[model samples]
Target: MPEQFIAEESRSIGHAGRRELIAWAFYDFANSGYTTVVQTTLFNTYFVGVVAGGVGGVSPGLATLLWSLSVGFANFVVMFSAPVIGAIADIKACKKRFLLWSSIGCIVSTALLAQVGPGDYKLGMVLVTVSVIMFAYGENLIAAFLPELVPEEQMGRLSGYGWGLGYVGGLLTLLLCLGYLHWAMQQGMGEAEAVPVTLLITAVTFALTAAPTFIWLRERARPLPEVSGERILAASFGRLRHTFREARRFRDLIRFLMTLAVYQSGVSTVIVLAAVYAQQVMGFDTQSLIVLIMVINVTAAVGALICGHLQDRIGSVPTLAITLAIWIAALLAAYFAEERSQMWIVGNMIGIAMGASQAVGRALVSKFSPAERAGEFLGLWGLVNRLSVIVGPLSYGLINYWSGGNHRLSLLSTLAFFALGLLLLSKVDEARGRAAANNFLACGDS
Candidate 1:
């Protein structure tokens, strides 16, 4: 009778836990619409092909350059601001408030994109830049909540679930956009008219879906004592500097970050170049490329779920190492693929590795971070990720230019980053890193 009672209580607890996780995961679902429809698939092409060419009087090549510059500028802004914002939020115990504001900013900016039409290229650029910066802030803020929501052991699985759900969201959003485009075409709507409608739909989807996260997720971190503006700035910078100065004590954590930066460069490069590679090398048409991406989204979700479970059973770092190995293998396969059928296999492999590596990386960082400093550290994580955005693509582009547009050689160059990351990753001791973070917290408290 006692055993039965205990089992019932455990089941009840599990049910409640699942509810919280779902609410948390839904934010990923909400924002993914923006990523898929606005950032990835439709808006950029619309902006370049229609707005820039038709209205702005720019050549396609120059329009592409302008778009790239806008994105790079936005990333630069976020890279500098994220850590400071995160530190302030931690001090104020206001992560949720910041997240809400950023999310709203992104939603409004995206919705306003419906106003941009042919020859409104400047407006389009401004809106995209602002929306992207806000999205980055929201991403950092939401990640700060991970340590609060679950224990270290469960972090990997929960992170995986969130990422997996995010991909599902992306898939659904893409399908919605595709359906809308098809319908709009039948109704005799041109690309310019139809694209703006898709942006509005994305904005609405993001705003509505993110509501659950705002409603259900609690801010558990306590605020530090209130400070003057000068003191806050001083303290934020001081703490950031101290983190770097104390890197030796947290050697494993620092090592892991270094490794992550290297591997992520390759990952970012692959993401930016994959469609181009398929279109150029494998001769995939527009519809075929879209289908390929859709399949990858599905495979990515599955990979995240599988790796999330594996992380708990083995360890986060080990899981990450395995994923990186798969990535290297996938890249090699992609470089060598001569036929469309072979490229499909490589695409799925890329999906699996991309999902697993990303999920594990986030969870590992959370595990190594003190609960009180999760935001600040995750902010640093964002910084490294943003920096990689510059390094990866630039390297790939340089190699391509040097080789006179030899894309296969350019693709193979990414292997160097991955290999270097894997080597650095081997030196990290996850348990020691967690211990170091705990020790720092204890000393600070004392």
Candidate 2:
């Protein structure tokens, strides 16, 4: 009887762990529909080409600027609010609640996009901006759960698992959108009508897939001291300030984040500009660009899985350095590619490097952050990630503008960001950073 009871207990633990991991990964799967369909593939173009023009009848350039401003404004909101919200979640032990509300906000806003049509550009912009803000917050909240689910040793692989799964989700969602678009066109529906349906599909997919995460993932962290409305605000800011001070004590973490900021800027720029470069320089059509993205998605998933294992064996810093080296090479390839086929090769290389760099970077930050304050620290991580969205594209655009739209020369500027990031990253002491986090937590507790 005793032996049977022990066996049952062990089995239950294993089952729960597996369930939790799947639930966590599903959030990534769920969100990728939004990322791939709305942000990446269809809706941005739909807005610029159809809604922006029909409604306000704005110039193409102004419409493009408005779209950019909406995205930038969303990032700005998240940039300022994420840390405070994270601190509040940490203090209140309500990360899951925050995640739930944000996910719902995103879903509702995205579903409402189905209502946007010709002459509804302003409405579309508002919905997209709100959805982006909610999505960004959900991303930050979900990532804070990583350290809780797995130990430091297993974090790299698990983070990789989540990311690889995410790419798969993105790929699948993109394929679904493509199929829908094709069918809609066959039925004599134009993009304006078809695009809204895709938005609905994305909303449904996100809500359904994210259900498991809300059900299975348990909140393990304990709440800090209870506080009321004004005190909550005061305490959250105070905690954020203290986090900055504590982070200074952990210099390596600070250095690593700085390095991440630099390299990620280049990475973000490459992703944002890749299709544009391919279309303008290589003269690839929409179909070819879609095929290229699909291929990249597959390679990215493979790279994430492979590099996750590499990170466990070689350590995050080294694995990341290797990935950065790949980025440098990929950028150089892009700069010099005179033929479309060569650009295709560069895209594949970028895929591999992109997946590995992102996965390893997140795991490295998790390994270095204080266990108790993971939310606040990862919030700061979100901040840097958002800031990179601004700096990277701006820098690339400036270079392109100055050089009379010389994209090849603009690509070279990305190389500079990667090279500087690599140089700064080499200086980070991963062990020392991990130790500093542990030591600070211990001293505070004592």
Q: Each candidate's lDDT (Cα)?
A: 0.80, 0.81
Candidate 1, superposed: residue stretches over 4 Å from native: 1-16, 47-64, 116-121, 226-230, 280-283, 397-409
Q: After superposition, how far is residue 219 of candidate 2 from its true place, in Å?
A: 0.9
Q: lDDT for model 1, please.
A: 0.80
| lDDT of model 1 at position 190 | 84
- Cα-based TM-score, every candidate: 0.89, 0.90
**Candidate 2 per-residue C-alpha lDDT over 373-424 given as tens digits, one digit per residue, 9 for 90 to 100:** 8888899888887777667756666666667667677778789989999999
Per-residue accuracy of model 1 over 313-355 as CA lDDT, tens digit each: 8998889999999999998888878889998899899999988
Q: Worst ten-residue run, lDDT, model 2?
A: 1-10
- Candidate 1: C-alpha RMSD to true structure equals 3.9
C-alpha lDDT (0 to 100) for residue 143 of candidate 1: 89
Which portions of model 2 show Cα errors greater than 4 Å?
Answer: 1-16, 48-65, 115-122, 397-409
